[model samples]
Target: EELNMDLFSNCMDTVERCLRDAKMDKSSVHDIVLVGGSTRILKVQQLLKDLFNGKELCKSINPDEAVAYGAA
Candidate 1:
C-alpha cells in the first residue's frame, strides 16, 4: 500500500506536468492509455480512474507489447 501510494504520487505529478506542458486540461483528454507492466497494479489503475473522474482506460494494446507496437 505504501509503495502504491508513492507510485501514485509520482504518476499524478507526471500526468499533471504533461497536461500542463501541453496546455491541455484533464477534461480535454479523451483516453488514458496505460503502458508497461507496472500499470497492471490495481492501485495504479484506481488512481488513474479517480484522476480522470472514472473515465475508462484504454487497454486495447497488450501492456507488454505496447513498446514494440509503438516502435513498429
Candidate 2:
C-alpha cells in the first residue's frame, strides 16, 4: 500500500515538473500516450487519468515493444 502511494506521488511530482518546465498547462495537453514497462502499473495509469483530468489515454501501442519501435 505504502509503496503504491509512493510511486503515485513520485509520478505526479514528475509530471507536474515536466509541465512546468515546458510552460504547458495540463489543459493544454490533449493526448497522453504512455510507453515502457513502468506505465503498465495500475497506479501510474490512474495517476495519469487524474492528472489529465480524465482525458482518454492512448494505449494502442504495446508497452513492451515501444522501445523496439522507437529504435526502428
Candidate 3:
C-alpha cells in the first residue's frame, strides 16, 4: 500500500481548521480520538501530533472495533 502525503496533509489541514473554527486551542486537546480506518496508519498519528504540537495522542481502542462501538 502506498502512503499519500498530499492526502495526509489535507487531512491534517482539515482537522486544524476544524479545531480553529471551534475556537479550541490545540494545547487543550489532550486526546486525539481518531476513529477512522485511515488513522490506523502511523503517518496519520504522526501528522496529528505534529499539527497539535506534540500533544499526547490516545489510541488504545481497537481501530476496527472502536468505530463500531462509538457508532452504536
Model 2, position 54, has a per-residue lDDT of 93
lDDT of 2 by residue, 1-72 (tens): 565798689878999999999999999997787887889888789889988999988898898887788789
Judge candidate 2 against the unseen true structure and give its global Cα lDDT, from 0 to 1: 0.87
Candidate 1 lDDT, tens digit per residue, 32-66?
Answer: 88899988888888888898899999889888998
Sorting all predicted structures by TM-score, with the top scorer first, yields 1, 2, 3
The lowest-lDDT stretch of 10 consecutive residues in candidate 3 is: 1-10
TM-score of each: 0.86, 0.83, 0.78
Against the hidden true structure, what lDDT does model 3 obtain?
0.81
Q: List the residue pairs that clash in candidate 3.
A: none
Model 3 stretches with alpha carbons more than 4 Å out? 1-3
Q: Clashes per prediction?
A: 0, 0, 0
Clashes of 3: 0
